[model samples]
Target: MTRHETFARPTIADKDFVLATDLDGTFLGGTEESRRKFYSWIEESRDRVGLIFVTGRDPGHVRDLTRRRGVPRPDYVVGDVGTTIAEVDDEHFLAPIAPLEAEIAAAWNDAGMRVQAALRSVPGLTLQSSGFRFRVSYDMDPDRFDDRAFDIVAELGLDALVSADRYFDVLPKGVSKGPSLLRLLTHLGVDNRKVLVAGDTLNDLSMLTMGLPAVAVGNSEPALISALEGMEHVHRAREEGVGGIAEAILHHKLLQ
Candidate 1:
């Protein structure tokens, strides 16, 4: 798992490529060597491969990673668990996803404060301060989670994604990583076929199911692997973290 193997170099004939990946166990889960190799490839292929971060993290959290962990700065970020999207520049300022925000926000039936008040009494649900215009997150004790809480979300026309057995995220009913990523792709005019998605958990399920080439890292949650079972153009990598991602890139012949 610690091997630092590099894949074939990008060819001149290679078409434009975009990599949309979840952080946590997917991007940051690999061995140091594998991560370094992946980062080197990204830095070297900057012109041919566009890097995007499709994460549940907020903008500030994402910024911290790039600043402290040497994570490559992303061209765009779909953060707040896909409720927010922004274009990032070299200087690290984020330009809000204009024109699309209105559409995405229409799904929020009530103010975040209102939703918070409604769910406050739900046992085992602790609000996470990392929230944005259309998303609210909470840590839940799965054993204590009550269907009534979800009922409240449904009544309010919101959707909930519970992942890793603990995170309870509430967002607009129709918004998720997949649709948000696709929206960003359309805005950038990137062909779907030229994209490769990577993830390792249930929250990442939407992006993996998008039918673009995908990589499920070896350490992916069982739920994710089960959900992705029999899917085409999806590679279940043997290596964990970026090593798995590297394997998928080679398998798909994206860099040769």
Candidate 2:
């Protein structure tokens, strides 16, 4: 099956609304050919879609790419794993959210106090001061970091998500792509049911949970495809990188 065959477009015309997606490995490709496809998707869908970027990257990097390349700026951006929301106008401006680093730090230290702490924990698994913190398992066997790190974060009450190949991001308990996307939906007065989200990692899972409709690109982990398997509304694109993203949108008839 080709990438476009992954998701069947609904016959019913839904509201014209949101297209929220991730950046790395979704829109922008790691190589030149894929990058062009990313740009093509924007050009093809710009007028019909309310383009929003929900990414783990900082808002500045998002803006920098837009400014440097002259690509269409996202209407709304949920960045730093939902720690910052930006409303882009003539310029990209940031709206800050509550910082959760201190709380995560406190939790780690308290876990250390327990007599039977399951694993060796980092003192303050602080990735940066950028609202949320990412903690990697220090005791992880070199070959098993992904599974181990995921296990650690799963124990937390906060919104913990894994991404790329090596890290897990910790967000405020309620903040995630779904909630962040809905916030943009509310701002635009668009119906949530019309939204379509696409991505390739664990961080993308929340938006899928929104139960609107979601597309997991071909490069996405096998576990994700299995999780979404029985859901008719959830689709998996066949192409990798940006080409896959276009297939997802077109296959879902999001551009129309």
Candidate 3:
């Protein structure tokens, strides 16, 4: 076995622990080797390192992405920016944690009317329930939008969160990845100290800043890098995308 493999795979009681990573641009970049290594790591470290995917993609899309890429399903999935949390069981997403559904329902209804009206003004834009928020996107851009959309959201007193590229995620005030991660932590009886997070996008900011040992997967955006650089526990990955993930996994000795 390679030295890297020796270091990457460790026993659970050897202080091996869990990792919560963002999926899209971090680990799976729609590449063959990337997908191969990702699944390899997951399968190798399955017993010791609990791989949890904390992504902004909705559950359905996450399922499709995993199936298409041939990656092992995550032990836990924090989808739609923490709108819904679920566990995977052999092609099925089971054991949902719907704690926020009631709150989400109330929050959505409160902002739906105004948000819908504002979204309608943007051509090619349609709204989808993302579990925790409403997502507005255009067909041509899918994520692209002019400055006017943000302005309208501001005027309507709604929160507009941009995940990646040009996509718009509108969440209620105070809903974010940090709290969602906390909820999961509590449910699993895992302390924050035992968690390690890695991400590479705007939506990952909250969990990254939650003071866990977080690594920004790559150069990321200058603004995001700057915002997170000062955190004593945060580290930057040596490589971009999944390479960074591998680096962090090795550097931290997260798996035993």
Candidate 4:
């Protein structure tokens, strides 16, 4: 049985405010004090605040973050660079929604091996050992990296994404954080106006530009900032990490 099947609570759709944020350099990015304050605030406002971690990280990492490290667990997760859509039950365990992942799986078509084989000769790319279900990720060295890797992925009919100049990912054609989040919101009857999307890298570009209110934290990569030019709905926060999230929350008046 699904972990959340027996648990009962007001779904995020019922909450007045919901935060769909990226980790690493957004929700978990800020200073210790800032993260503490932000986490404490969410713990205090449990009834009003709905949290979702939208990240490139996989489910196992999400589980460890909350269960072991005490980061406030999210009600839902749009994880694996949007390749995974799942609910985090009251017990803080993730349950993938099969229906939601149907398309992602189809697009992936068990291409991890093929992708690896094709890119094995590329320099400066070290495959990550996460054993991702729908994507293949690599630790990248920018100086020696081949830009043609992008072309290789395209030729395979998949999408290629690089973030923070440190990580590279090959995903299903057209799958990424933004579209997956939209699917989750729609399935849950969430009010888009009440949602605030947050991120600090290029992979986040898809979601930030998806018309939802968004924040590009102060420490965001130049590539991401450059892409957001003239996009008024996105707030450029002065605070780094979780601090930036708090700034955006106030800037958007989400909690007020």
Q: What is the C-alpha lDDT profile of model 1 across 1-256, one tens digit per residue?
A: 3378766754312438888999999888889988998899898878798888999888888888887879999888988778888988777766778776677777775558878988999998999866477888999998888879889988888888988888999889889898898888888778778788999988989989988999999999998899998997799999998888888988988766
- 203 Cα displacement, candidate 3 (Å): 1.3
| Local error of candidate 3 at residue 98 (angstroms) | 2.4
Candidate number with greatest TM-score: 4
Give the better candidate number (1 or 4) by TM-score. Answer: 4
Error of 1 at 187 (Å): 0.8
Q: TM-scores across all candidates?
A: 0.91, 0.69, 0.79, 0.95
Question: For candidate 2, what is the TM-score?
Answer: 0.69
Each candidate: what lDDT?
Answer: 0.85, 0.61, 0.69, 0.94
Encode model 4's per-residue lDDT on 53-138: one tens digit a residue.
99998888999999899799999999999999999987888999999999999999999999999999999999998899999999
Residue pairs that clash (backbone atoms under 3 angstroms), model 3: 10-256, 11-256, 143-166
Instruction: Tell me the tens digit of each residue's lDDT in model 2 across 124-216.
Output: 232444333323222223244444544555565444565554555555556667676666566556676667787777777777767776778
The candidate with the higher TM-score, 2 or 3, is 3
Off by over 4 Å in 3: 1-15, 122-157
Model 1 TM-score, all chains together: 0.91
RMSD of each: 7.0, 9.9, 6.7, 3.8
Provide the lowest-lDDT 10-residue window in model 3.
131-140
State model 1's lDDT. 0.85
TM-score of 4: 0.95
